[model samples]
Target: MCARSSLIAVIAALACTLPAAAQEPVKIGALLSISGPFASPSKDMLDGMQLALDHRDNKMGGRAATLILRDDQAKPELAVEAANRLIRGDRVDFITGAGLSNIMMAVYRPITSTETFLIGTNSGPAPVAGKDCSPYFISASWQNDQPAEVMGEYLTKKGVDDVFILAPNYQAGKDLLAGFKRTFKGKISGEVYTPLSQTDFSAEISRVRAANPKAVFVFYPGAWGVQWVKQYSQAGLQKKIPLYSSFTLDEVSIQAIGDASLGMFATAHWVGDINNPTNAKFVKDFRAKYGRAPSAYAAQGYDSIQLIGAAADALKGDLSDKNKIKAALREAKYSSVRGPYSYNTNNFPIQDFYLTNVEKRGDELVLNTVSKAVEKAKDVYAAECPMK
Candidate 1:
């Protein structure tokens, strides 16, 4: 009788421990470019994700949460190493934050193949959106080409016949140029792909000057954008040649470039001025928390956490079922700062793109949404994705 009683006590103890163990805080691993050229945008992305956590009182789905951050240094091999550590050592429930396409590409296979959810805050490489789409991989940001496609269509509508294009020689650079060509229907005077490491755009500016197209379009993000715009202004090309770009003139870059970025038009998925209750609250809270306007990078980062939280809520904080988490993410049951949001078949976002112009508003530069360039824009590669 005593043996049976002890067995009963052990069983009861085990049952009692189950719920406590189940209540373990959700662990999120974020790999960001914390100390590189991408640092500025990465910081904003981190801040945005942090804000989302703050909104939830650092809890998700009635459970405490822990965020483990790793710096990729904008290097592919380093990203892979960091991802391995996050997956093997930390055993994070979700891995988020890859600010560059190259870094995303490097870490995608390891995270997704393991069936661990990779909630990409930024960096939507094309292959992952198309033939290589994985159920475990979902982008909280738009595909790499979406913004450029918007810019292409916008410039085409404005009747720009010829344009010079430049971009850093990388996966995203190639993707952006391809997307631009897809919609522009314009003559390309000169198409240049500069080295990613190159900061001096003097040669590129000379090339642009020689091609002397009606307009110039480029996709330079982070510090690269700042230097490129500053040089372009210094060369006095902004006045002569109408400049258009995507991901070039953002709030972070605008602060660095100041008046140089003024009048420059770019295409993006979200701007601070986007009129929506969700965005209004995000912009207000982000400013209050960070003392600066959030960039599109920040918006995407913020959305990434919201996505994870929504999925956790759907599962009632039980993250053991990977399939259920993926399903919850597919539903995207949370409000997006960019307004209407849904996932494409490939797990990329089907969202809107806007034509944004950098302008001065009361001693501060802002990326103002001028017009809706594409409504509920879906990436061109969605049809190519094998996933249903």
Candidate 2:
């Protein structure tokens, strides 16, 4: 009788120890440029992602979610290798991230073929929005070209013409200029493509001066933006050429450029100017936690995790049941930092964009909105997307 009673107790303990419904951690992988030219936004991305995870108590639905990360160093080859490790070795259920468009492009094909859901933290190239749209892939952020698309309309409305364009000589660089030209409806004085890592821009500045365009638009982000803007200011062209940019400067870049970045105008899909209560809390919490204001990149990174959690909760965190989880993701039912956000047919954001100017707000650099949300903003290739 004693032996039988002991066996019964052991069985009861085993039952209690078992996780509900065989719950295992839903694995996700992130490939970011944590230690390269893209480090500024990369840090923001990490913080934003972690903030969302913390908000969810580090669990999605009833199952724990695990995120494995690897730094791609902002290099194409490195991005591909990192994707390989995540997909083959770690066998992650999903993959996300890559700040630069070139690095995202390098890993695109391999990731799509893996049948793993790949979410973008940033970096949206045109091909993915159009022909490359896959059932397994979704963009948690706007396309690379969308910001430039908004800028194109803003410039056209402002009656600007004869603009000079500058970007790196790469696949994404070419796409960015093409994106601008697609909507501007103006004369182009010149379209110049500098090498991806060109440090000094004295020669390019000289050429731009000779061109004598009405305004100069650039797409340099991260460290490149700092160097380009610093040189542009020192060349004494800040006043001569009304500088406008898409992704040229942000909260992160402003610190690097210091007072030189003031008065520069840029456009984005998200910013601290969003007056929603949720965002107000995010800005306050983010500043308190990281000692800095969150950029759009950081905001989006934070939103993506919230998105995943909302979907998982709706589906009762049943990751093994793919259909239910995918349906929940499609619904996109969550209070986003952007206030209202939903996925287009191509699995990209169909949200609003804004025109923002750089300014010092009480000793802290901030993006001051000159215009409110430009509604119904669509990517240049939205028409090409069959899903639409």
Candidate 3:
């Protein structure tokens, strides 16, 4: 009788342990330039992502959720390797990454093919939004071209006829110019494509001066933008030419240029002052948490986690069913910081864009909205996506 009772207790203990073991937490793999020039916004991404996770006690769909971070160092090969480790070694349920288009492009194939959901918070390359789009992929952020197109419209309405375009010779840089050309009725002179992360802009500024276009548009971002803007100001080009850019200057990098960023206008899907409950809460919580103003990139990162959580809930915590998860993702049901957000057929965001100008307030330089340039903006390449 003693032996039989002991056996029964052992069976009951095993039963309890079985359920606990089966309830393994869901894992998400994040790859970004976490330690290099892009580190500032990478930390912003983490802060935003963690805020969403904290609201849910770091669990989704009644299952614990874990975020694994990998620094890609802004290298394409590093991004590819990181994706491999995340998908194979960690066996993550979702993957996010690559602040730059070239790095994202390198890692895109591996993640999607492994049946993992790859949601982008930033870095929306054209091919993924167009013919090469995958069912497993989604973007919580605007495509690379959307804001540029808005800036083009803003410039056109300003009575600007011809303009000079400058961007890096990369997938995103090309997309920036392409998006601008799609909407703006202007001549693109001195169309220059500098190498990615190129600092010295004296040669490019010379080209801009030689062309002597109505205005100059650039699309450099991060430390690259800081160096270029400082050089542009020193060259005295800002006095001669009105400077406009997309993704080149934001909360993350503008302060590095001090007063040089003043009066510079740019375009974005979100600014610091959008009046809505979701945004108001985000801005407040972000400042309280990170001790600074949040950028559009930070908002996207916060939204990405919310998106994954929503899909997980809709699927009843069953991430094993890729088809159901994919369907649930398309029907995104969450309070977006952008007021309202929905995916195009390509699963990229259909959002709006604002014309923001850099202005100073005592000791702080702020990005303030001039006006809304486009409403319910949709990407031009979505129509080309074959995903049904």
Instruction: Give per-model TM-scores.
Output: 0.96, 0.93, 0.94
- Model 3 Cα displacement at 99 (Å)? 1.7
The top-ranked prediction according to lDDT is: 1
Q: For candidate 3, lDDT tens digit of each residue in 111-166?
A: 89888889898889999999989999999887999888998988898889899998
Worst 10 residues of 2 by lDDT: 18-27
In the order shown, the candidates' Cα RMSDs to the true structure are 2.8, 2.3, 2.3
| lDDT at position 153, candidate 2 | 70
- What's model 2's overall lDDT? 0.83
Rank the models by TM-score, top first.
1, 3, 2
Q: For candidate 1, lDDT tens digit of each residue in 1-388?
A: 9999999999989878776636588999999999888999999999999999998899887789879999999999999999999999998999999879999888899889999899988788999999999999998998988888888888889999999999999999999999999999989999999988999999999999988899999999999999999999999999999888888877888999989889889999999999999999999999998899999999999999999999888887878777888898898589899998778899998888889898888999999989988888899899999999
Alpha-carbon shift of residue 275 in model 2 (angstroms): 1.2
Q: Which candidate has the highest TM-score of all?
A: 1
* Per-residue lDDT of 231 in model 3: 96
Candidate 2 has a TM-score of: 0.93
